[model samples]
Target: MPKGVVRKALEGFQPYVPGEQPPDGEGWIKLNTNESPLPPSPKVIAAIKEAATDALRLYPSPTAAPAREAIARKFQLDPTRVTVGNGGDELIELCFRAFAGAGDTVAFPTPTYPLFEPLCRLHEAAPSRHPTEAFAELPPSLGPDPSPLKFIVNPNSPTGALFEARDVEAAVAASSGVVAIDEAYVDFAPRSAVDLLNTHDNVLLLRTFSKSYGLAGMRIGFALGSPDLIEALDAVKDSYNVDRLAIVAAAVAIGDDQHHRKVVDEVVKNRTELADALERRGFEVVPSAANFVFVRPPKPAAEVVAALRERKVLVRHYDREPIAGWIRVTVGTREQHEKLLGALKEIL
Candidate 1:
């Protein structure tokens, strides 16, 4: 390749870094990613196994109607109003493609999901980051000229802080363009923006089967919005974006409300217990509504992360300002938490 042949916008573009996954799961308490420590429902597993037949010879449904309808039924929305994707990440990128363009602005709260800014940059859109506490305090003039695209991670990631539905509704009302609410962690929260879809045509609620449903390996996610917004996403998303096995697994998983509730209840319980324990240990832990806790330990976050790694217990650590000293720990199984707590005791 010739020098400088790449697009100028690609220059200095930084990618989103995900949680580290050690090659082997042996002897490691993996809690960096907010994945459910529990396994998927038996029905979901059986559904995937059933789907792995000679059907692989043909292409899957382009619209992924089975999974989409299941999601709609679960949320009590119309099937036409939901668009399933490869994952929540793809749905997020699709929003940028369908709504914003180069030089358009994308807004989100800082110290939230790290992927949003990179997606904006990949599409050459300007990124506008606001403090999470001040996210709803948008200027009156923000909706006019730039036609900003907004992204909200409800029960926001890394920190697990949740914004009330009223706050989100107000932000959507103030926006001229699309507002995508990433609700990957909403099952652990008290409320959801799905209710806002009834009143607001500009709002899109993104969800995943990864966290609550324990289908991370399947990589299925979806978006719920007005029919118009759903159609827009469908227009830009790749045909057959969600494969057959994933569609089957997600559909089965979505239908099993009992199993979903069981997993979520367990995680929420563990989250509370873990947060209380961390607080008791003198860590300034942020109250979380998701399946993780953001904590400011007694020592530097980098040092703690390194020490934990040495002890084979993993947690997320960020190296940015404002939240640079804090670490995010995914609420794991009770036994896993005990191991993490033991490791922390030794490290501290």
Candidate 2:
């Protein structure tokens, strides 16, 4: 607790704040975090249970080979091009270790992923933020930022706005550093930047089982890129960064392609319905490619958020510039959306 005991770089660091996780079965309609509106594939659950054996006493594959192989097969990429992580969030941190460093600049568009700014501070790296306007466009300066590492959150958070594949490729092509395209929500979107991998070795795509796969609690994610990039991620990753059960869960989840498609289909269908419902209520809903809708409510976002909390309805709100007065609401089932809409009607 001593003032000087902590690292100098973390002297006054503020950590990333996640969404409210109220106790389950409390009658609260949770819509803050972009969790899957459904449970994970039954196969993933069964596999995890089967893997919970005396073998747990042994350490998991340091490289998470099974998961890497499964992910590679799913994406039709070579196994060497895959690297599994605790979550897509961990992969973002590892990019800092593998590419960016102290005093190095980490570039990304402003107000993309809030985690990036805090991670930059945690790693003692400088943040090179470029601004985006109207529909969450990629920052114009991003392509020229000579930072050692850069990030692009496709189907970008909060705004949920997706960029053109050509535009994203242009940025990656122009960049002089490692470009990480965070596709954590791509399964809900129309296109992916995976093709950029064939043309550019410096581009890495981060995917997660949390959103579309409904495995947030399992904490499984993977990266796809050139073999060299994956090797660097492996080098910087913690030993057994992903646990045995999680690896099994990932493998089974990836194998159950039918379930994966069902999950995406449901979320995408519900996302469209939810966005339309919000717009009808006079909320200026941003065009979302992800499983959430970002909108400016007709009233003060802070007030609306607080009122909803009083009614046990949770949604994320922003008070900062640019996105101030906007709220991000995760797409839940139709029943949950009804509850949320009812609460908004009462509050308004």
Top lDDT: which candidate number? Answer: 2
What lDDT would candidate 2 get against the real structure? 0.91
What are the runs in model 1 whose C-alpha is more than 4 Å off? 1-5, 133-146
Ten residues in a row with the worst lDDT in model 2? 133-142
lDDT of 1 by residue, 5-92 (tens): 7788888778788898778747889899888989999999998888899989999999998988888898888899999998899999
The segments of candidate 2 whose C-alpha lies over 4 angstroms from its true place after superposition are: none
Model 1 worst lDDT run, 10 consecutive residues:
135-144
C-alpha lDDT of all candidate models, in order: 0.86, 0.91
Model 1 lDDT at residue 124: 89
Query: Which digits, one per residue and each the tens of the lDDT, describe model 2 over residues 120-161?
Result: 988999999888876667877789889989999998997899
